[model samples]
Structure formats: C-alpha cells, structure tokens
Target: MGQHLTIVDHPLVKHKLTLMRKVDTSTASFRQLLREISLLLAYEVTRDLELTSVTIQTPLQPMEAPILEGKKLALVSILRAGNGLLDGILELIPAARVGFVGMYRDPETLQPVEYYSKLPNLLEERMTIVVDPMLATGNSSVAAIDLVKKKGAKNIIFLCLLAAPEGVARMKEAHPDVPIVTAALDECLNDHGYIVPGLGDAGDRIFGTK
Candidate 1:
C-alpha cells in the first residue's frame, strides 16, 4: 500500500484480529483483544512521525536525543467503539491530547449524523489521529474527518481495527490526503453494510450492547 493506506500485518495483530472475529469470543475477551490489538496498530499508525533531536547529557556523556517533533498528538476517537482503541493507545502515548466525535446512522436514510463533537484546540499544530474500530460503511469515518478538517486539522490519520473494501474505497475518494492504518482489510461489505468474514458490530461487541 502507498502512503494513503497501511494494513498492519504483524503476526500478533493478525492473531488478535482472528480471535476478535470469532463469534464465541466473550465480551470481556473481545474487549481485551481489541485493547491489545490497538497497541500494535498504534505503532504502525505513528511509524512516520517526524523526529527532531535535542541535546541532552547522558549519565556518561552529552548526546543529541531524538524526540518527537511538533506538539503532542491529538487523538480523536469516533465515539463509543473508538474509545476501546483510544484507551489502549493512551497507555502508550500518555501525553497525547484526546478528542471525541459522535455520529449515529439515521435508520431511514442510512446516513451518518453527528450528534456530538468535542475537539482539542490548535489542531493545525499537532498530528491528529482518528480512531474507530470498524470501517464498514465509511460514512461516519468520513463525516468525522470532515469536521476535524474544518477545525483546521490538516495532518490527520485514520486508525481502525478492521476495514471493508467498500469503506476503504469511500474514504480514499473522500479524503485521499489522510493516511489510513487498519489491522486487516476484510473481503467486502455485506448487503447490510457489515464486513464479510469480519468481526460483528464493533460498538456492540466492545460495549456488550445490542
């Protein structure tokens, strides 16, 4: 994949994804596995972050230490299910700023509608990463990024556990400038807009909701 898309194929990531996809995986187990997988995905999502050096004295001698360039990252979770991934990523990057975007699908129209939004200020100065567990239809993900970009977020990345081809294509067409990092790109979306051979409704699975 080019800079526009990155599928994290680490052996451990694939193993955890398989476990999460199982129908019998317990709610607790599924949640835990998502947390574990998020940590792995975080590595790939942030692989290309810019770095700057700082002069520092080690215990023995002076050295120029490499430090992450720019402001602390801004992590925007596409609410509910996104929180599952956000929690694990926060443990790895404790200093990152957090934000939220809530979108609900309108049953009649089958389109995403924003109901809540809270984002960090100065988004233009930081790298923003949008998190959502499933990229099945790509409606909410695209809408969420639209809001983020409107608030001056130019450098952004989309992170998710699983992606469907239809969703990937939709995002590529809408936000080609944003890079997408996902654990696995599944076969395709079913008629009902769920991924085939993929984990079921991520929000329900993560929250143990209907």
Candidate 2:
C-alpha cells in the first residue's frame, strides 16, 4: 500500500507557498512565509486529533466540554531545514513535546548519517508528528522515522512543505503505515537532486546562507 500524501490546498497555504516559491522574495519574507505555511499545514495535520469530553464549570453553569485525549503529542523535527517548520507548529501545539534528529549527508556515500537524536519520554504513547521542509530523496526522512520508531513511536505522521514524487514513493515503500502530508508535489527532481521548480534550497533561502 502507498503512504497517504495529502497536498493541503487551502487558500492561505497556496498563497504563502507561491510567495515562498518566488525567486525575488527576500530572506525575511521567505522566512515569514515558511512560518505562515507551517501553521496552516499544522492545522490540517492535526484535524483528526482525538478529543474527549469533560465536565467543567462555566461562568454561568456547569457544562461538558471537549479536550484533547490520549498522550500529549511529540513533534520531531529533522534538523536544519526542518527546524523552520518546527517553529510554527510549536506555536499552535504549544504543549507538544519537542524532539530533534540531526542528520547530515555524506558526500562520498550520499547517505544520511545521524549526528544527534533525542526524543521525549513515552514516545509510544504519544502521537508523533515529524517535520521536514523538503522530502527530496526521502533518505533523511526515512532515517529520521526509523530513529523515532526505535524510540517506540508507533503513531507517526510525516509533514513537509514540498515533496517529489520519487521521495513520496520511496517513503511509502519503506513505511506504508506512516501518513505523509505536504503543501505540494512538484515535478521530478533535477540533475542536482533538487525538486524541480521548487523553492531553492529551503535552508539557504530561509536563513540567507549560501
């Protein structure tokens, strides 16, 4: 079975994504656009979060209200570019536990190697949402997911701002159970392995680095 990849077509998300895609958008504007898009993505990603009813006293009388059920969520960010998405999601899920998995590509092997990994306690009990701005080859995202799974995260969702078809297919093959949500699925990756017509190097654009 293929992994579920949802391209959030919400109006606001589409607008911000366009701004981010423009070559002329300034670094400040690019960073702000990313934050806005992430928040919109987070909203769609968490739409199905479990909620339970509770009885509480209101200003006038007692009434039943619904509150989040199950364990608090865990937001695992694939470092560097992923950190850009992490900030906005955190603003909405303020109580969510934060985790980081840092990986760097080996120039020789062209493989992802973990430099750091840390997650919250009781990961198995929490609904973990992993964020990475771009899913190109899917190697880094897959490795990050494996790390979290080893830490006992059964319920996982992969969130990205943009994705390539190859990357999405790779992830589905590796982990069919994980759902992938993204802003857009672009054309094939170019010869340099960057998503075609994709926002140039998300990390570089957002941070104003080379």
Q: Which ten residues in a row have the lowest lDDT in candidate 1?
A: 1-10
Cα lDDT tens digits for candidate 2, 1-210:
143899999989988999999999999999888998999999999988999999999999999999999999999999888999999999999999999999976756557899999899899999999999999888899999999999999999999999999899989999889999999999988766689889989989988999
Q: For model 2, where is the 10-residue window of minimal lDDT?
A: 103-112
| Candidate 2: residue pairs that collide | none
Off by over 4 Å in 1: none
Total clashes for model 1: 0
**Overall lDDT per candidate, in order of appearance:** 0.92, 0.92
> How does model 1 fare in lDDT?
0.92
Off by over 4 Å in 2: 1-3
TM-score of 1: 0.97
